[model samples]
Target: MRRGLKITLVAVTGAALTLSASACGGKKADSDDGGGGDKKSLKIGLAFDIGGRGDQSFNDSAAAGLDRAKKNLNVQTEEISAKPDEPDADKESRLRLMANKGYNPVIGVGFAYTTAIIKVAKDFPNTKFLVVDADQCKVEGANVSGACFSEEQGSYLVGAAAALKSKSGTIGFIGGVNVPLIQKFFAGYQAGAKAAKPGIKVLPPKYLTQPPNFNGFKDTGLGNEAAKGQLDQDADVIYHAAGGAGIGVIKTVGQAGKWAIGVDSDQYNQPAVAGVKQQILTSMVKHVDLAVYDFVESVANNTFKAGTKQYDLKNDGVGYAPSGGNVDDIKARLEELKAKIVSGEIQVPTKV
Candidate 1:
C-alpha cells in the first residue's frame, strides 16, 4: 500500500506513512556559462497537477515559489495543468509545446510527469528538465533535477503535537494516495501520536492509490463525508495530507466544530474556507516554495546539481505551520515539540 511516492500524484506524503503505518525522494545539473557560470536569463515552464490554481496546495505552493523566482531572478515563466483526471497522460504534447515555445527549463511538478519527462527530455536534449518528487526521473538529452522533501520528519512533530493535544485518545489522517510517500505521513503521524501518548489510536479514513488523484481531494463533499466519518468514530483532530483534498477536510472540520491540521502550504491563510479559520490547529509545512525558489536560483547561478534531494525539518525545509487561526492555545506545546525535533532530541522517525 506504500507506493504513495509514485510520480503520478501527491508524491512525498503518499510514501512516508508506512514503516509504522513505510517511505519516499528528486534531481538536476548545471552547465558553465562564461561569467560566474550563471545563466543571464532562463525560460522556466511549469506543469501543475489537475487541482489547478484553486488547489491552495501542492500546485499552488509550486507556483508561489516559482513566482518568487521570477520576481527576484528575472526569469521568464509559464504553467499549465495536467487535468488531475489523466495523470498518466502523455503531457509530451505540453512539454513539447513549451520546448517549441522557447521555454528553456521545463518543469513537471508532481510525479505524474515521470514517464512523460523521460520521453520529453529525450526529445528535447537542449532543454533542461525538472520533476518534483521524482528523484529517479532521468532524461537523456535534458538534465532532470527532481525536487523532493522529507515530509515524514515534519509530519511526525505535527503528529506528536496532535496526539498531545487531543482531548480524545483518537487522532486522524487522510491521504491523497496510499503510496509510500503519503503513507509516510500516516506512519510518522501514528508514531508521533503513540510517542506523545502511548496507545493513542490514529484513524485513516482513506488511502490514495493514484498519485495526484484528487478525486477525493477535490470534492468537499467527499472530504467532508470522510472527515465526518472519522469524527463519527470519535476522532477529535483530523490531519489531512491530501493536498487540495485536505482543504476539504479542513472545511468540513470547521463546519463540524472540530480541529483540523493543514499540510504542505498553510491552508489557514487562504480565503476558501475562512469560516473555519479558527478550526485549523496547525499545518505540516513542506516549504515547496523554498524548493522552487532554490531550484530557480540554482539555475540562474549555474550551481544546479543532480541526484535525489531531501528537505527535512533539520534543514528548515519543513515544519509545522505558524499560528494564524486559533493556535494560541496550543503554541506552548507546539513550541516544545519543535524544540525537540529541531534539536535532534526527538528523531521524528522517517521509517517507522
Candidate 2:
C-alpha cells in the first residue's frame, strides 16, 4: 500500500538547493503563493513513525494524505522513514534537514516527534511545523501546530462492535507500546465492551514492548505471540493498536477462526491483510490523512494557524469502519453510541 522513494536527507537537501537556485534565487516563501499567477506549490516533508509507510496501518493513512496532496494540490513531497529504535537526535536531524531545505509545514507523523518538533521549530521560526498525535508545541509565537485526534472515541465504537459480535464472553486488547497513546485505545475499548455487554470479560491489555523500545509496532512475531496467548485464554475477540504488528494478530486470528479488530486504517480493506478479511470484525479508523491534507491545504492557502486542532467523531475525523459488513448488524447501535459520545452523554476514558 506504500509506494514511494525514500529521499535521504543529504540528497534531498542538495537537490532542493539546486531547484531553489533556479526557482526564486533561494528565497523561501512563508506560505504558498496563491492567485494562480506564478503560483509556487508548497514543499512538504513528512517523517514517519517507527513502522514507516508500508505498515498498512498508521503510516499508510498519513501517506494517503500526502498522495491526495500530490494529486490535488500539486505540492512537492519528500518522505523519510524512521529507523527502529532511533534516538530523538535522529528525529531532530530529519526535521532540521527538511526545514533547512526550505520545506515549509514539515510534519512528523507520530507522537515520538514531539521533542524533535519543539527543538527544530525554534530554529526555523518561519517554517511551519506540524506534529500528529502531539500537542506540546506551545512555545509562544512558535510556527508549529498539532493535529490531534479523539482516538478513544473510535476505539469505544469498535469495542462495542467486538462485544456485540463476540460468540465467547472474553475479549482482549494488544497495544504495540505501553505508552499513554496506546493506553487510550485500551481504556475506551474496555469501557465500550463493558457498556455493551455488562458481563463481558475484557482481559488486561498486553503490550508488545515498553517505551524507548518501539519495536512492538513493527514486530509481527510479537503480535502473533500476543494473539496466541490471548486465544489460548479463551479470547474470541481481540483488538490491536499495534500498527504493523497487528497484521500478525489478524492473520493468527483468521487462522484460528476468531475475530480481530484493526486500528488506524481499515484492515478489512487493506490488501496486505486480504487473506484475513472475513475474520476482521471491524477497525477503529483514525483520519490521519484528513489531518495531514487539511494542514497542507492551510499552508497552501496562506491560512496556516499555529495551534492544536482536535479531530473527533463530531467532525467525522475518527470512527469505526464496517468494510466487510461483519459489523453491519450492529452498525445502527454503534452510530447511536457515536451520537451520544458527540453529544457528550458518554464520556470515553482516555487512560486505563
Candidate 3:
C-alpha cells in the first residue's frame, strides 16, 4: 500500500502533448515513437525549505543529490528557496510554477511543504512530486512521494558520543524550533546520553523559537547566545539541530574549548566551519542526498514510485559521521548500539 498504481497513459501522454503544444507553438507534432528524438528529457525542480543551500545542513544535502543527478544523468534542474515565515500559499505557487514550466518530479525539501504538496498535486495530475520529510502526501495520489528518515536513530549515536567524551558529565541540546520534528533529535540524544552514562546531568533543552517564529533555524546570533548560556551553566558538551544557526553553536563550542555535535550534514568537513572543525566531535549524518538522487534516477528510468521512502539506520540512511578522529576509540561501542537499534533491541524515542 506504499505506492499508488502507475498513472494511466492518457494522463502522461495527453498532458505532455498539451504542454509541448503550448510551449513549442504547434511547430512539432506529438509523436508516440519511443527513444530517438521522441524520448522526453528529464528535468527536476527543487523547492528548498528555509536556510537554503549555504546553510551547510539539510538543504545542502538535497542540493548535493540534485548536483549528482545533473552530472551523472545529465538532467536539467531548477531550484527555488523559501523565505522565513513564508506562507503555505507561496509554497503552492512555487510548485505550480515548476510544473507549469515542464519540470517533472518536483521536490519540496522539507516537511513544511506538506500542505502545499497536498493541494497542488491534484491540479497537475501528470507531473510527479516529491516531498522530503513529510509522508502525508503519499495518500494524496499516484504522483506524490514522501522521503522520510528516522532522525532519532542517528541522534542516539551522537548523543552517546557526547556522553562518552564529556569530561564535566554535563551536556546540552539546542533545537532550532520547538516542534515535533526537532524534538525527535533532542529525545534521542537524551536517551542515548543517559544510556551511555547513567545518571548523567543533562541541561534542560533550549529552543531558539517556536512556531510562527522560524528564525531559530537560521539565526546565528541566537545559536551563539544559547550555546554560551549552556556553557556558562557548566554544560561542556552540546549538540545542535539548528540549520544555519548551528554554525554559531559550533563556533561557540570551539572558542570555549568544548565539544559540539552537528546534525543533518557533517559539520566537521564543511568548509564554513573549518576553523571549528576539531571541536565538532561528530555529526548525525542524514542521507538527504541519497534520497534525492534515487528519486531523480527513478524518474529517468520511468520507475518513479509514489509513496513513502524511509531512510533509517538499518538502510544506512541515517548515521553518525566519523569526524575529527575524536571518537575513534569509541567507534566499536557506537557500532554496537547502532546494531541494537537496527534490530529493535534499543528503541529510540522520537518525542521529548
Best by TM-score: 2
Q: TM-score of the candidate numbered 1? A: 0.82
Model 3 C-alpha lDDT per residue in residues 215-332, reported as the tens digit of each score: 8999999999999999999998999999999999999988899999998998899988899899899999999999999998998888988889889999999999997798999999
lDDT for each residue of candidate 2 in 67-102, tens digit (9 for 90 to 100): 888767747777787877777877888788788888
RMSD of 2: 5.0
The candidates, ranked best first by TM-score, are 2, 3, 1
Cα distance off (Å), candidate 1, residue 128: 1.7
Q: What's the best-to-worst order under lDDT?
A: 2, 3, 1
Q: What are the lDDT scores of the predictions, listed in order?
A: 0.71, 0.86, 0.84
Give each model a TM-score: 0.82, 0.90, 0.88
Top candidate when judged by lDDT against the true structure: 2
Give the worst 10-residue stretch by lDDT in candidate 2.
14-23
TM-score of 3: 0.88
**C-alpha-based local distance difference test score of model 2:** 0.86
Please write out the lDDT profile of model 1 over residues 31-93, one tens digit for every residue.
223245555557787777657656887778888887677556646566776654553544666
Stronger candidate by lDDT (2 vs 3): 2
Evaluate model 3: give its lDDT.
Answer: 0.84
* Model 3 residue 286 distance off true place after TM-score fit, in angstroms: 0.5
